[model samples]
Target: MNNPIVLNAFRFVLLLLAQVLIFNGLNFMGTINPMVYVIFLYWYPIKENRAVFLLVAFLLGLLIDIFSDSLALHTLAILTAAFARPFIMRFCFGVNYEFQNFTFKNTTKIQRITYLALLIVLHHTIFFCFEILSFSHILLILKKILSTSLLTIFLCTLFSSLFSPKSE
Candidate 1:
């Protein structure tokens, strides 16, 4: 059998490089960017250690921050998503869901979308909140959150639908 742990590590590296080297540069609409890179965290094996999850999240965010030069908001957003992952997974898979086998191929598209939607919203929420900590302009924050979330959802859904395995 393939070692899932090693496979995930390999995935992490490949995805990170893709995000940093290519995706980050593709500004779709000025500021409404689609960060599909965070999907790595979203797809991480639920059975893995929480500490490892958080550490990986922090490092992932750090890399984005370094590459994007954006005041660590990416790290903060990813870490928040990491922290909330268990709860999200539980909601998506039910309380009895097995983490090791959680996957889009095994679930309905709606279930997958719901799971990803919540995390995408949560991630953008945390990210923009930090971006607007001063709370100086309510309108701008609302606009950014809404626009970014919409764009991100569209892109993530597109990618998930395209790449998800054909069969379990």
Candidate 2:
């Protein structure tokens, strides 16, 4: 039960199903859809193989894209987030990120929040930019990104707090 691989696989399936079945149909103010699946990227092991992480990220986004019929938007956004995760972590966690044994559980709350916010904002920005694909609707893109990112951050924080393993 404590195996990281099994836990990750379970998280992947659970988050994927939640996004496709629940979040996909949900709309607030007609456009804000909370993308809670992004949490999987945050929760993935830091020491895991980078290739496998990117592959899983692509597959996750591909699955969401298929369900939402959003072409490749989710795929691109998620892959970008996954690719940029190390840099984000380094920025948030400072020198501690260089250690192979580093984990989010050991980080400060502010660092975790900042890391989550950056990733969510980045993912939403890319997603909305390509989704709208129009300079005329830049306001609309920003609106969607802000609203959706807030909702996602809240939900992700709530979910992570609820499910996160307690420090012994």
Residue by residue across 1-168, what tens digits does model 1's lDDT show? 157678678777887888788777777777566777778876676677899889988998898889888899999999999999878978987865665565556667787788898898899888888878867777787888888788878887887667653443
Displacement of residue 148 (Cα, Å) in model 1 is 1.4
Compare the candidates by TM-score and give the number of the best one. 2
Error of 2 at 59 (Å): 0.5
Candidate 2 displacement at residue 131 in angstroms: 0.5
Q: Lowest summed lDDT over 10 consecutive residues: which window, candidate 2?
A: 159-168
TM-score of each: 0.86, 0.95
TM value for model 1: 0.86
Model 1, stretches more than 4 Å misplaced?
Answer: 98-106, 165-168
lDDT of each: 0.79, 0.91
Model 1: pairs clashing at backbone N, Cα or C within 3 Å: none
